[model samples]
Target: MPTITLSEATFAKVKACAEPLVDDADSVIARVFDYYAMHHAMYFNGRLGIAKPNPIRLPIGSRELTHTRLLTATIDGRELHRPDWNSLTREMHELARKRLGSFEAVRKVTSANLRQGRFEENGYRYLPEVDFSIQGCDANNSAESSLRLAKAMSISLHLTFEWRERDDASHPGQAGMMGWDPTSRDAGLMADGSSRSWHDATKQAIERIARDRPRREFTLAELEALELGRVVKETGSKGATPEATLRRVCQELRDEGYLDFLDNDGTYRLR
Candidate 1:
């Protein structure tokens, strides 16, 4: 029922941060802040911008030519401000140095070497170049971890309704709120209106539906057939379409790993 607006620059930054993980808006905002912190730390600390005219000596190791080459390789020919360039190069150098001793040693380290060395290390090894995958039971365990995270956040349906006494001359419109938490099968109601009894009854009905019908799979048509569908329609919230709301909620659930799409179809299965 609420609308959010942002400036073009803010919207662009959010989108850029969300790339390859666009399903979660909260995650996108978090990542945008993280990116800003890493790239703009120096600027915030009184540097004019990301680039500086002078290059400072980095503790990358003994070989000067190899250190320069490594820094250049990490930058990959990007037109970064000098400070940003320096920071990125330093990070890469430290990462490499954790495993390799000197610049020359790090220069000899390649993706192939990383892949080969991954299994050789123990206790949370950091192999930057390795792409690791677990098959069979390990993947099932990973899925369970995702499920745990989703459950920790809990799942709920939030409904807000506005009410006014049509026959009472002195009454002002009041807002009411109701929410159903599927995890606990609990429904809560808060009202600031003369129609408190009606809102309370509505909340009870939502609780009954949530407790009794407990569904693992969801579809727009299925959701529209429920009591929630009627409630949303009766509320007359701006731009609140039953089908769109159902689709958006389903997408959010899927992104949080509480649900998974089945064969890229319109239906979703609880994860």
Candidate 2:
């Protein structure tokens, strides 16, 4: 995703929007919730290193709710039954309580993720990219809007801050990423946007696309081709043969189909 500038008006409207729950939420958390609803896995690398991307983490009950809505036992070719929110929430809340009780310092809690970008204590990050919503609010940087939110909400929740999202949306009061982060290459990132770091945004994008359409494998070239809707014209002097690029793409990406692409013209999309 190219950088998008949230307009001052949009910020105002967002702030003016009512809180999602009766739970204690100042403007800061409220805005965070808004963005979270839009993008569970978000990008929020802060220049000060205080901010990081944190994906949402759901209470298992919440997952069951999700399972109810998205998962049809017969669809995945699995043999089993599904339940509803009422049944799942019954136990999910208890599980969340038990899990939180096991933690020591409540201060250790963080809502943002690390995989979306560089995380620091300055650098800790979060994962799963779904249980949370992480994005750069640059609140201090967004002095103008920050003031508006503060004034409207009648609180001092931010000194210029960023919004935090997590997958555990149903568990609104829960704090922090569940277990820090997964120890895997999925935690990597690319500053140039050229490399997908298994961050929250990419995770959400992949899920949304997969849910909405036929899931398949493709490369950047192919995805780009697919997104562009087939080629009408091709450019560039055609320097070095793309063979090297294609070779590397095949080697480095998942063989599952990261490099496969669909092209009509120059336009391409992941198949």
Candidate 3:
């Protein structure tokens, strides 16, 4: 964790809030932050105190977001009108640049490596106006990027993502094609929320490849052939666009340092 300096009065106040036997300074701070995450707070008698949650807020459930689209984001109660992932990424990077006092400082952290400074290699595009490199225009990627930046800058954010609800007969009791748990850090939630079936199918195929392949290298065709039936059974949907999903999965895995894309012909190998 990064070191932060606190005044003697503030430190004493924080110590007073700690648990008798179990809470250390770090734990106390974390506990306070956890409480703040769930509840609204206001100034009471010149001191901050818990307040009621805002009456008007987005319908973001406890579950992680899946198959969703970016609509707007409210940061520390200030709303930003970002219609798409590209706009949101640009906005967040620009905000970070300004706060840090230089684009070079921001780049040092976000670049692929300090030595190479390969921003584009990491799916980022340089913005001349902001003097920053923003991530690719992907809803989940952009959301994750913004969340990461907020954490680093100690800023607060509440994102609103929209998705079309699935038909009752097709999905039954679910709001959309799939449900996501909001608290999960895993990309399982909200990543490919709009087309969860394809996402799941691609993951399923990848799992089979990792488990069954001897050489650990396979083409897209082999994945489709081996796991199509199982993927259908698991997701309750056929592979509508296997090629596209495969490409998406490949890129995701590559970024995660799990697989290496071998060729334009759709061959990939586990690393």
Candidate 4:
């Protein structure tokens, strides 16, 4: 490995960016550069560092995500970390007890009726506040359960996962790429635009259109006419006229390299 020495001042700054026990030297450097590149509209070539690309922002209950190795969750602005899904479940219960008031209320929302199996088989974990099972689940089921529990308790949970897609098997040794999943459903929780944002809805609509439609290049008028219903269904807030909003989102997507605005005439070609 090549060695690059840092001065004492630089080393201290790097250490400050570290996530205590979770991040090592390589990851610390990778994170700093990734943040810089994202804001400056630059790209960081993979050969320069061990870190993989930065994580994407995903919606919770995304059916497509199978598993994640590490997760950071922000519950109503309070952040917490857990190593795995089971730990996340336990942490959610603890937070719900503190924030959701009565014990019965928590239990009513989280309990799985215990008639079918023994405690060990079910992987049941008992707390004074609630009793819930956390074992014998695949990643998809676990993620779904977490979403269900959060919604039932009216808890606003924003989750970020360090994970790699199945196709990334080509680079088996690479560190996990990150993705954020905001699962909060409460109307009051819409304050941060996580739950209700025109931009988020528009982004989702574009992705859906890209995946479902065969055509790569779409005129602005066609997209506005075709996807207005989808965007409206995804989010309740739409601030501007449909044409203006779609135009702004398409321009943003073009700037982000997901599409190209050819000839400046409002036709978008997927990139």
Q: What is the descending TM-score order?
A: 4, 3, 1, 2
lDDT of 2 by residue, 14-129 (tens): 55553223112244344354445435433543322233345332210011121112111111122223321121221222222244442221112222121332332322222232
User: Regarding TM-score, does 2 or 4 come out ahead?
Assistant: 4
Ranking by lDDT: 4, 3, 1, 2
1-271 in candidate 3: lDDT tens per residue?
4799999998998898753433468656755654564344342331332222222121111222333444456654577763444566677677777786775666543422122223554445566655545545434455656654554455666665444233422222222211223233232232233333343555666777775668778777777676553443333223336455456556655755677888999888876
Point to the candidate with the largest TM-score: 4
Residue 76 shift from truth in candidate 1, angstroms: 42
Q: In candidate 4, which residue pairs clash?
A: 55-178
- Weakest ten-residue segment in model 4 by summed lDDT: 184-193
lDDT of each: 0.36, 0.27, 0.50, 0.51
TM-score of each: 0.25, 0.16, 0.38, 0.40
Q: What TM-score would you give candidate 1 relative to the actual structure?
A: 0.25
Clashes of each: 3, 45, 11, 1
Q: How well is each residue in 116-228 modelled by candidate 1, as lDDT tens digits?
A: 23342321223344322111111112222222222233433232222222333111233333333344433322122223222233334334444444564555566567665
RMSD of 2: 20.7
